[model samples]
Target: MSIIIRKSLLELIFSGAFMKRWNDKLRPMELVEVDKQAHKMIVAWLLFLLNSRDLDVVRKRALGESLIEGGLFDYLYRLVITDIKPPVFYKIKENPDDYSTLTNWVIKQLRPRIMPLGDDFMNRMTAYLMQPEDKGLARRILHAAHLYASYSEFKLLKSINRMDHELIEIEESFIERLNSMRDLVGVSELLDEDSNVLGGFARMCGRLRFQKRWSQTPRVPETSVLGHMFIVATYSWFFSMEVGACRARCQNNFFSGLFHDLPELLTRDIISPVKGSSQEIGELIHEYEIRELNRVVLAPLKEGGYEDIAKRLEYLLGLEVGSEFKASVNMDGTIVEATEEQMAGEYNIDTIDPKDGPLLKVSDSLAAYIEAHTALKNGISSGQLHHALYRISNRYNETPVIAGVQVSALLADFD
Candidate 1:
């Protein structure tokens, strides 16, 4: 396929000097197309031409042919017109085996007339945009890009400002939504666990504290599925680290914490009232949860050869009651995997680091308590904070776990 752009616009796009000099002299010229494919590719090419001055001519030509050959002109056109630039070069270069000479040739030929934004920048943009459309970040980026691409720089700047304002608003909303979920998920022992997909779990948990609810559920807190996973994972890391567990164990704890409630995503956080109706009914629900978990999170990951991740989580969770994991497990560890009643059973398992569960639980409780206390400071004062703390303290017989650790008493250091 062949398409042509006026040499002047090509220079305008490629040579900033020419663009500046001929800014007034230049007039729009129709792009000549040799075929339907050529026409589509030219639209794609011109869209990019608007931003690229450093792309070599050879590369531009190659890009044109590649766009045509790969049936990517439409995608590229949408991207370019929307202020999103596709990675026409790097995606091809990164895996030459997938995109060999023909692809490379097209990219090289079309290179000169386009912008030379680095591949990393393009890839990050792609990743950001390609996320699920419902993602707040993606929506913000799309809105910003739409305004920027269609308007002059002056308008674009304002559009950017508005977009930022919207983002801040959304962030606040997200936080309000995630607060309850954050508490429920309860960042436990594995926040810093090491799994390829779960490595950022801690940050994710922290961010959940800020998620906003989109739905109205009086009993259920407004939180995102991702937010819950993040907090639980973080708690897992804290637990493991405080317990002085091995590095591998620490990572496993993190992964386990992240996925412990994954079944909830599939099962929809069944309330205890319904779940505890009868032994058979409860068992049936549990069975369904396990099956759905295996079918969704576990199966997909294993099919993708990510069973290692699942195993890591399960190991950290100590889901499989074995001789070895018993001594090392904490109260939260058992609670995550056990039936509510089973959790209350007189199971005497000595804590490993002695300070592990106490530190983690205190940290978790204190975080929520502080948040509630802050609300009191904001003129929403109720006896709720004090009463809640009293009830919680009374549960442990008022003998808190951090009694002996001076460092642990300094909860002010936590952010």
Candidate 2:
């Protein structure tokens, strides 16, 4: 159902006490014109808040002080001075003091929610926003981030559809930048300590094909995050394309790969055998994962009144609880019965041809090679790798596979 949020209603929504008192109240069918504009502006503001590195609300709250000198005035001035048109400037100017008051009030209210984020991270995010040319693009990216945080994958489809081409492109570019962040040493390090953890986790998820090897390593290995993500993104894209899925679906598949490993950040990459011993053990481990993650990764954000990062991850992965995680069972001395799905939904691209199923098959093959390569790098035997390769070639012989030949060619890389 559609909710028509207006100014008066928004004031209530923004009011912490008021919102709590009428938690069940919903918006009506109609909105005043001013209210509609208000809605758009608020949406835009939220979009800006989420996507931009500048507004580190969580970090600011966590630090227990305003990092920016002018408080909300500093924020509004930054907004207006950076790419805001003359009319928007005039609107701000007409009631400058009132706007300042409203903005400060909003920030004060939000500060409680964002304080857990810490000051250091908040400063960096604000600095990113201070860059002039990035303003419009930043807003779009922030909007996508916010929508993703609030809704489901399907909701992302709707959100993107509702955006104008310019905004969509802006958001896409932003996402691309985020995808590429792991390639840089500074960015990867910064993300580990701050808000870009989402991006860092995405890169890890995309790299899941390298799991056993990655787990065995002392750490992620400085540039391994980039290397793994490239592999997953490439495989996901190739697989979806061969299947004839639409570009959008293919993109989502790539994103799915990117997000697959996020929970590992919180849970510390539990190996499959351990997780599969029993349901109770698994649940206990799951709870520990959430607790540790909140303490290490999300507790900082809690100071700012933000929701649980693990809970946000549950929404992203589309699971009600962590019980749905994949398990790998050792069937015999060199055989493993492994089943895995990173997200709740089926891994199918509607626009792609059914024949493209081979792409998924290829992704699996490439992942195996990455594991083998990593294992070999660490001086492990290639026996398991060879066994997996044998399984795939054997499957192809039994059925005609799309891009079967191309995939076979790529398998040579594993060897």
Candidate 3:
């Protein structure tokens, strides 16, 4: 909870892990060309948005019949699909029985992870998607966008050696289909002229695939900034659940974790050691990141009438908190009410409160530890990674709890 620990958590989140997808093995791509964890998170977020749309219609139609809700189906679907070994996926694609087996395998793997809801939701999802009916306008549109994003990522990786023309055509076709369905889905009513915002955001998220992590480490798989964001977000979500976070707090933490490093998209991944070299240097870097973020990211969104979204991002990224370092969200997702003296004296000192920033910091460290452990497991050797693992482990060893969650137990799961 000290400033040093807080800064270290931020550093680790920005530090990329080398994660290799099965597909990368077939191509000339490096062993770790993609951030597997991050990609899954992005897919999850997309699905969350899709499922979040049209709650009113879904509630009315429920009419007492139970229906799966809250984007869980979409999230689970992407999580399983992304983790599928490439060769297995290819085999499934080639045979009907294999695909069926794959689906069952996915259900089995996910069943234990998702408790309480159990197989009922998973079974419903399998049955629903197998032969989906017209669920609603929003559901359909979001579903198309999810498919488009997933396919786009898969096709691009698959066609690394192929000509761009085919890829371009495929993308164009997908976009055309999405645009055609826009009016039918009443997107204008939902978002007005800002209907294109989601698409634009998707494109930006895609850029993370190109921004490689750990530029200095050789012979290791590279993680993208975007992917790191996803991992942090996912970790934060699960950690929030462990702490019994309210719905609004969980959502805020997830999103905050998702965009924690959005500034890196503009400034690139500045390693933590460099930022921590000196207090003055770190302050200067922070200043520059905020300026560029406002000019390049937030200002434009505001100009485009996405003020609400821009404000949310600002809060998530701690832009609004400034130097006070207070909690970002309350139990209801509203900004935590704290005077400057109260924030500095109590909140800053007791950094383990069940607020957004501290919880996110803990999740960030957990993610960093996982990334380092994963890379080490994959036979990559780096002193920096080893040091990171040691440092994180040692730091958390003395601290066993955060916001009522057993932090040590959560980290132990990685071991």
Top candidate, metric lDDT: 3
> Model 1: per-residue lDDT, tens digit, 1-415?
1122222221222111111111111213111111112222222222233222356655543332332223222223232233212235335445646445533443444344332333432343344323323333223222222222212112213333454544455345434543322221111111222442231332222222222322222111223433334333444443443444444334434434334444555566564446768989988887787677567555654664445555534444344542112223345544233321222223222232111233334434443343344444445545655554455545444453341222223332321
Backbone clash pairs for candidate 3 read 32-221
Question: TM-score, each model?
Answer: 0.34, 0.35, 0.69
Model 1 TM-score, 2 decimals? 0.34
What is candidate 2's TM-score against the reference? Answer: 0.35
The lDDT per prediction is 0.35, 0.37, 0.55
What is the model-wide C-alpha lDDT for candidate 1? 0.35
Question: Residue 96's C-alpha lDDT in candidate 3?
Answer: 62
- Tens digit per residue, CA lDDT, model 2, 1-415: 2111122221222221111111122322111111111222222222232433354544422221221111222333332233443346447646757555644554455444333334543354445333323334434333333233222222223443454444455456445654553332223332342355544433333233223334443421212322333334335543454444443344434433334444565555565447767988887887777666556545544454434444433332323323222211212322121232311123232322111223434454455444444445556555554454576656554543333224544444444
Predicted model with the maximum TM-score: 3
Regions of candidate 2 where Cα sits further than 4 Å from its true position: 1-49, 52-230, 273-287, 290-312, 321-365, 373-415
In terms of lDDT, model 2 sits at 0.37
